[model samples]
Target: MQNEPLAYRMRPQTIDEIAGQQHVIGKDTALYKMIMNGHVPSMLLYGDPGVGKTSLAFAIAGTTKLPFIALNATKAGKKDVEDVVADARISGKVILFLDEIHRFNKLQQDTLLPHVENGSIILIGATTENPFHDVNPAIRSRCGEIKQLKRLTTEDVDVLLKRALEDPDKGLGKTPIKITDDQRLKIADASNGDARKALTLLESTVFASFEENGVTVVENGTLDSLIDRVGVFGDKKGSHFYNLLSALQKSVRGSDTDAALYYLAHLLENGDLVAVSRRLLVMSYEDIGLANPAAGPQVLAAIQSAERLGLPEARIPLANAVVLMCLSEKSNSAYVALDKAISSIHSGKTGEIPSHLKDTHYSGAKELGHGGYVYPHDHKIGTFGGWVNQTYLPDNLIGTRFYDPIDAGEEKRLSAIYNKLEKFKKEK
Candidate 1:
């Protein structure tokens, strides 16, 4: 317990201890009352990371004193569901906290249907993405209600920080630390409504500022050093460089060519081709993804040309890339999908690679259950096709699709291909 991070150690034991999300976990809320009564219902919890999804699930189980089994959809397979069912058989009921529940494909979700229907395995699904957009309809329909945990308020984060500083058992109360109230608030503000981030910063400040005499003074300079981990555009916190980059990206993403060009010129005038180029490349994929597949290479080419041309001349190719990004059909579906996949991984959802997808080039690989590799080239569907319905993901994440192309420009064609492949896979 002492070795665990402060955030983990400070997780709310019951919903009452939860910092924010009053609308759901407040004492007067029906959900709070239900959990207090030991009625743990199957439900979906969605929100950005660090907003207490897992904490809420754990708090519910704690309040109810029920068997809590936490698993991640990207890692857990049917066997995991069976384990929960088996636990329910003995305990009469079990709370299965399925993190990244949106990653559960059809087969895995289907396996839970009977158990969920019988009230043996009460499902508590948690995800950062919109459940309706990613979760299968069957699971969504069965869940009582999809609850969204909003980001923690600054006040809420500050409250947690203070609590952590004072709580001897689960926090840093044992350490002799000193910090101004303003500095504390600054930490909260820097965290941007993330309690975990706030705690991490507080912990960092304590350790970095700790003196040889067993005392710590958390100063603004120490905080600045730790908080500069983000904002690649600037060395100082909240500098104009960061503002320009943010404005530039937002302009391009919003399809404001004029604004995008304005910011690009401002950045170019500031004389940092590398930063501007890096941002343009990101905008190509992050803002104008598959909708304009060529935008990536086009922007890359522009960057290379600009690099060779240098300075005032570099602005020419750079401007071209910027305008192209702004006017192009915009779609963030690609990165959104990837972000969801990344969120699942961050939530400890990574699983072993499926046997069929494992490398078979090594000696004695077949004896290790790494056989049955399917060559997609062998099953060509149609023209412009070297594809087959194969399980390329881990067995648990078999049907998870991490690249959801949108209906825009070339991505429309990609979406069509994706839909066709999905249909074919389902048929098979």
Candidate 2:
């Protein structure tokens, strides 16, 4: 057990050890309450890689003292699930943690449905993919709750790094290692929200350095060498990879065609197709927006082609998407309007839904004055239009506006329609 990798040895024994996921594992949350009460349900843990899915499963089992058996879905077949079922039958309920549960075929997943349904097997399916889109619906619905875990922030990773260094039993407390606060934080930042990466780099950096008279010293450039293993972050300074991505987005948004291409070339040279594809797709909507509505679909098509092609062949389509984004008419109105609406919600400017808009589908809803909603389709004022004015907002905010469409691209037409709607609203 002591010879295991640092990340494996440092698995969180309880929810308290898992950082940056207070939404699920917080003391006041329903999941935490259930765990403390010794009633953990079968659940699907979904998130990016290294985001504590398996750690959470281990923490739950440890807290409840349940038998935990982990099996990778990619390698585990129907027989493996049956073996776990046999164990469950002989020794009471067991926690079956299925890593990469999305990879299991329908038949393999179906084999465990009966055991999971009978309460003999407590299923904990962990996957980096979204279960809603990837998993079999039968398996998804059987899992009572789906918990989403997020990547640890730099600060959170730094905290974990400190704990790993200080713990005497499970960590390197006995080792005479000297690492400064900023040096530790540098490893955390380079980790890119992965706790495993931070700890692994710390272990590697500590071991790679020559031992001085008494201690292993982690100097300024120690972590830089470790980060250089991945080609995308070869920014000499060790932190310019994300900065380069930001420069690409800003250049496209500013309509600097040459600068956008320059950044794109540099990012391409790093061989990070996933990163490049993500930035292009975001730029299509966030920069070009409704001004060039077609830009989104065009960029998506180009990206799909690039992904299918891969690498040097992929760069051609990626460059096309970048050039189109740089030249497309720009507008941020779509997301800006959404941001204003979100701000209003946060500021407590919301009121109860108007009586007409309230749900009338339930029993006895009409008796409570919930079916007063007027159908606009029934009151047509023109042959081509079935428009009737109705107040969607509450009475307190009848005139409050959230969307202010700019006169750019297709929004010019949308702006004219918006004015007409407002005119009819005032008359009503």
Q: Can you write out model 2's per-residue Cα lDDT over 176-226, one digit (the tens) per residue?
A: 888899889988887877777777888888888878988888877766888
* Candidate 1 per-residue lDDT over residues 1-428, each given as its tens digit: 86898989999888888999999889898888888887777999987667889999888888888889999999998888888888899999889999988789787877787899889988999987677777888998889878988878889999999999999999998888888899999888888677787888888788888575767887788789998873222232223466679999999989898999988876876678888899899889988888888999999999999999999899999899998998999899978988999999999888998888788899999899988877888877779568876777777777777877778998899899888888988987
Cα TM-score per model: 0.58, 0.64
How far is 25's C-alpha from truth in model 1 (Å)?
Answer: 1.8
lDDT of each: 0.85, 0.85
The alpha-carbon lDDT assigned to residue 101 of candidate 2 equals 86
